[model samples]
Target: MHTAITSQPLPSAAEAALARESSRVLSACLQTRSDAQQIELHDEQGATHPVRVPVSALRLLLDVLTEIGAGNAVSIIPIHAELTTQEAADALNVSRPHLVRLLEQGDIPFHKVGTHRRVRYQDLMAYKQRIDAQRHEALDALAEEAQRLGLGYD
Candidate 1:
């Protein structure tokens, strides 16, 4: 019953627009994926929406689905648990260098057995939580600012 998104505040007009645009683009992309299986989203509020997108549709959605589904609310079966540096970076929605910085910061624990850095499943989940929280905070702040300025989505 865990969600990637934490409720703090609403999203701003710009954030909403960006999300809408991204959704439109993603919907188009998902429509194009031959293997994209429509996923049915059942929100905690008892709302349900169906979308069929494959793992290759984009890295983020795949990771989200993986995270939610990995826990008590496991969506689909978990994919790769142990991933390489590039793969972990892709999953974290960041570049390799950024992930390395996170690794150095100890935001995510990694192992260097030999010359390769390997990120574990638990580490990836923690990183996702941190990333999601920051996004939520930014969107919340942006929305509040927009409201204070009388900005409208229309």
Candidate 2:
């Protein structure tokens, strides 16, 4: 999968300031629907133009800008992009061999591309979400059991 990320150098001071303001504007704009979701862009020539962007895209842009403002590295990978087994394993924070076993057990779906397996980014995300939810549920159940046994306090 192709990931879009900022280069090594983080955003400049001015860019960080702009990112803060843009984050506010994008957050506010996403909460309400206007006739057009537009933002002004200023070019090096000092010319300003309005550009329309989808609300979903604006949300992502806002998140990226916020992360950059906080001096964090950000990467955007398309949900539909295909990833190699190693890449998928990295995404899941699992070993490549373990990931392959999961694939063999039909835990995650995949497709073969000329003898090489490829997993969609969306599928990986889905599996991660499911696992996270299951973990949360199990934790909650354990907490409840502890409370019932007087091991947990209010």
- Report the number of the highest-TM-score candidate: 2
lDDT of 2 at 79: 79
lDDT of 1 at 90: 66
Predicted candidate 1 versus true structure: per-residue lDDT over 28-99, tens digit per residue = 556453655666789999999997556475646644433433332223324446667776776666899988
The lowest-lDDT stretch of 10 consecutive residues in candidate 2 is 1-10
Over 1-154, each residue of candidate 2 has an lDDT whose tens digit, in order, gives 5443223577788888888887887787788665458779999999999998877787788889998778666677787888888888888889999999999999899999889888888999999999999999999999899989998566
Clashes in predicted model 1: 7
- Name the candidate that leads on lDDT: 2
lDDT of each: 0.65, 0.83
Which 10-residue window in model 1 sums to the lowest lDDT? 1-10
Which regions of candidate 1 fall more than 4 Å away from where they truly are? 1-80
* Structure candidate 1, residue pairs in collision: 12-143, 37-52, 38-51, 38-52, 39-51, 69-74, 69-75
- Residue-level error in angstroms, candidate 2, position 10: 7.2
